[model samples]
Target: MDRNALLVGGAVGVVVVAAVTAVLVPGVLADPTDEGPIRPGPVDVADVSIAAGPATGETVTLGIETRIDHRGNPTQNVSVLVRAIDAESGLLATTQRVDVGNISRDGETTAATNLTVPREGGYDIEVALYREAERVDQAKRSVSGVSAIKPPYLQSTTSFTDTEALPPVSYSIEDAGEDRTTLDLTATLTNTGDEPAEDLSVTFVLRQAESNIVASRTTVDAGTISAGRTDSVDATATVPSGYNYYIDAVLMRDGVVIDTARGAANLNPTRTISVNQTTEDVELRVEDFEDDDDRTPEDYESERTRTESSAPGFGVVVALVALLATALVARRWRQ
Candidate 1:
């Protein structure tokens, strides 16, 4: 062959080899697997935070920042989950999921949801990325400045009962079904007093231990219970999973809570509520996941205050180090 032709042929062969290698290199290095649909890489939770929302007292907006970056294929129809957990009680207060219509090959987005803080306290805000039911990535952060409001009815005392031959109350968990994620409760209010109990309201509050937050609250009208007579009212409430819950029935008359009773029932089998849900056009409102755990708002504030106070000191140290390096360089140059 002619020398120039031979060189040109050799270059063409090298180019073909390079093209084949470029296509096969990644597969050779990657884990061997059976033939299946190609899977997208995981997304990451870059940052999580909570700030005060538009509503005052025990309501805040949880902010979750997600990052998705991969050289391979991109991900679509992914879910971003944000949960608020009480630091003290270890119970989840609320969870919100944002269905990312589609995430490009490389991008970052922030999704936020409003949640009621069970009480004024510190809380752990968790953010996670999910593909179907599988978790991709997650991150957690601490937050503070949640304010707790005391109910006007029971401000000074833990509970109250009228001394004047008050109405005797009984509470019952009529029927509880775990499959349906709901509980049915009944409250019977007896007018033991000589006079009739009028305008009575019976409320059932689902209480989780070690926290002031009520998981579910519903009211039933007792109307009027004649002397020595009883009136029964039924209440249906949706229960969240992951914690032991008991029902507290409070009998109220003319806007004042008078008699109260507590009843226990087992409902959750998995002992954890699933917070993931579908996305919507407007704000996403998650109902099942709620926050009822205990936490210390002061502790969260103290940590933030300490971090803010030390930032200036860190800057000073960095400046001093730079100055010292400059002085040493000058000395060395002179020597």
Candidate 2:
């Protein structure tokens, strides 16, 4: 055979051998079984909120927020969008979810969105929240999308009428005998919206404006707050120091933060009650004051964040000396 003909013939023979090997390899291969669990996608459902106005032509914004879990823990990759839906038509409308774009997740997020209408009008805006899975609930390659727009808000779904807006929070701390402090704080949280917040938790974090958290405690498990009804969750956290310090109260539901209010651990002996769904804080200093304590005011410390509060007085003195030296130099130059 010629050189070119020989090369071509050799390639043809190799092709024939590969075809035969492929035909035999299928019969020789073993059956493969998947040993992994069936992984499901992310939860689509999330709580939503709407702002209502008395007069027409008012701008309305719908915010959708959800908690997505991966491997049974909350994931922060969730995104939300709003869409226009025919109120009574039960029809799949346009892909309007793209207009709103994705909202950023701030640590754990609560979004406030504004959707401007054409005129003073009201239509059922079907909002959708999307979640992208980095690693899905199951150990497998997956993608997911769920929708929970029909459900009410996660923390609160209703609004309060004019009459039911509880009074502001009022509280004070009193000396409960020696080396003990009792903080009496009161607030009323009414079920403003339609749905109920289950496992509603209210915690009071008493922090010193000068120091970090001098004392704190979870005040209420507050069962199920009924719709349109108001309930109170007031607690007295006993600590060692006089509540000369002040801090704010934080409200959380299902390990999620919702609202916070200005609170004062005032050294007030007067007893008071906060009527509104808010908090009242008070503090009382001891009649006899001594300055020789070297430990934390209380032992039942939940969380302590030490900041740059109590800096040594030496720094202040040095700053004063530098200022004096600068002034003396200016005076000599003028002379």
lDDT of each: 0.62, 0.49
lDDT of 2 by residue, 120-176 (tens): 223455555555533222111111111222222233542222233454345665546
Identify the runs in model 2 with alpha carbons over 4 angstroms from their true place: 1-155, 158-168, 172-175, 268-335
List candidate 1 stretches off by more than 4 Å: 1-36, 63-71, 148-335
After best superposition, candidate 2 residue 8: deviation in angstroms?
84
User: TM-score of model 1 relative to the true fold?
Assistant: 0.32
TM-score of each: 0.32, 0.34
- Give the least accurate 10-residue stretch of model 2, judged by summed lDDT: 137-146
Residue pairs in candidate 1 whose N, alpha carbon or C atoms collide under 3 angstroms: 89-294, 93-290, 93-291, 121-297, 122-296, 122-297, 242-271, 242-272
lDDT agreement of model 1 with the native: 0.62
Q: Worst lDDT window (10 residues) for model 1? A: 273-282
Error of 2 at 325 (Å): 55
What is the C-alpha lDDT profile of model 1 across 1-335, one tens digit per residue?
79999999999999998779868785643446656687675566666655554443334444445454433556767777777889888898888788875565665655555656655777888877777678878787887655433343422222223333442333334445542356667665655667775677788887654343477888888776677765677778776544445567887766776667766554444342211221222221234344435437986788798899788646778889989999999999999
